[model samples]
Target: MKRDMRKTEREISKEEAKDILLKGEYGVLATISDEGYPYALPLSYVFADDIIYIHGAKEGHKLDNINFSSKVSFCVVGDTKVLSEKFSTNYESAIVFGKAMIIEGEEKTHALKHLIEKYSPDFMVSGLKYIENDQHRTTAFKIEIEKISGKARR
Candidate 1:
């Protein structure tokens, strides 16, 4: 599959791919709606134990799309710099293909904790409290990654 890339020289190892994923601040999640329309949205996420966790309002287009089909694609672009003189950009990115499912109870909490750790480490106490107060109003999903491909131009 690596040979399929337009520029195989930019293809990166799994470890390098995962590193870019971990450092990415936001990812674009792509899903197919019931009518076969494709929807893509940028969202905050947490990567833990090979699964990507995302949370949002319990009712929405994204959730509807997930219900229609579990298969989804998530893309994360880490760092980029435009090298005008070189007429190219240096960047690191990763794409993930996966199946997403709603997570509940302990699993949901676990995912939330990981998110807090990544985004609000300094406010752990308040984060925990906020989770308890807000968890019920939110919905969490875990994406079980089926295939991951990463590339970098450095």
Candidate 2:
């Protein structure tokens, strides 16, 4: 992606980066371990269609670094206000390069109910008592989008 004139040439349209990851909430998941080292976590995601849903705990360290490298890189950003210094840089960002798996039965309980109705839609009315007990204490995944790019700085 080397064509930088400070980079923006109108390239931010995978449904506008999935509507900024479905109205932007949180993102920053880059993983690589098994001694290769490089793990960044700050997740709370759920973007469908092109795939991107996350959840952890059934074990730690980002699921032992995606079970020793599933090669992932997910990102989402929207909410940066600094429109000055040449009148640009308000911000909207998305980056995804994926190959993460581990989603299990019933598509990991339907992607955790679409990540709880996209980050908690009023607790989804307790969704049948947390789908009959929090689907066995969290563990969901799906990155699949082998390529994605986005940008907006104004």
Candidate 3:
């Protein structure tokens, strides 16, 4: 990243960024469509290790877009308090960039389970339902981190 003092906020540690990504639950996913158009969609994600996992339909615009171009960007932001001022609003946000790859078989199954645990830990008791039934129908993709950066402001 360029050293732009104006764009930088309180630099968040890598660990803190990972925590935010893992716990934030919701994020926006950006992808390139077959027609060479940029597409951004709000999605729920799970962060494990250095990979961000997203679950979606077996067939749709997102899947089509990813298939056309593996390059993608994902971002997750934490709570923000509006600073009603004359100029602008203050906020905290985290962003990640990576190459997205469609995961299948065991990898996909594992990712799906991890996603469920992160976003809905309460349903863990019925974990078998996810491992067996849901896994067969849904699609999961992993974004292997090429780079990650986060910032926070008061």
Candidate 4:
């Protein structure tokens, strides 16, 4: 479903949106709990091959939510600042709606390694060691983005 942006000037191009997602430091993964409650958490992630990958413990609230429902949404804010004089904030952000699923084996390992490379590229030697030690205890999931939109106020 597509919604018209009230502020046409603020709508960002798809390429721009993809760039933001690729370079973003982190994003919030929103999920629905088994109890039908909304749960959102900030997470470190890596965007690769048109997929968003995140790593976490083998089990937790987020995992539980993903198990209960594959539908999820992710949001990343690029930059923001409060414009006190105008009483409006200037910001750029992207939101993605997608299906989330737990992945294992090589896919999981690749995602974990991608994250290590993104966040700890300077320490890859130890990063690989860390991944080797914690791989089994970690759960990696991928979000296949179905719809995405971006907006910005310059």
Please report the candidate that would top lDDT against the real structure.
1
Best by TM-score: 1
Candidate 3's displacement at residue 69, Å, is 0.7
lDDT over C-alpha atoms for residue 78 of model 3: 85
Clashes of each: 0, 0, 0, 0
Encode model 4's per-residue lDDT on 22-135: one tens digit a residue. Answer: 999999999999899999999999999889999888888999999999999999999899999999999999888999999999898899889989999999999889878878
Ranking by lDDT: 1, 4, 3, 2
Estimate, for each residue in 52-152, the C-alpha lDDT of model 3 and write its tens digit: 98888899999999898888888888877776674655556677878898999888888888887886788986875867876767788999987777788
Q: Give the distance in Å from residue 2's predicted Cα in candidate 4 to where it truly belongs.
A: 4.0
TM-score of each: 0.96, 0.35, 0.88, 0.94
lDDT by residue (tens digit), candidate 2, 1-154: 2343366685677778778877878899999888888999888978876688788889998888998988888888976787677676678888888888888888887788888898778888796479568778878889898777788765
User: Candidate 3: deviation at residue 83, Å?
Assistant: 0.9
Point out where model 3 deviates above 4 Å: 1-6
In model 3, state the lDDT of residue 136.
63
**lDDT (Cα atoms) of all candidates against the true structure:** 0.93, 0.81, 0.82, 0.92
Q: Write the per-residue lDDT of candidate 1 for residues 67-90, one digit (tens) a residue.
A: 999999999999999999999999
What ranking of all candidate models by TM-score puts the best one first?
1, 4, 3, 2
Taking all chains together, the TM-score of candidate 4 against the true structure is: 0.94
| TM-score head-to-head 3 vs 4, winner | 4
Where model 2 places Cα greater than 4 Å from the true spot, the runs are: 1-6, 11-18, 23-29, 37-44, 47-53, 60-62, 66-73, 76-93, 96-114, 119-123, 126-128, 139-149, 152-154
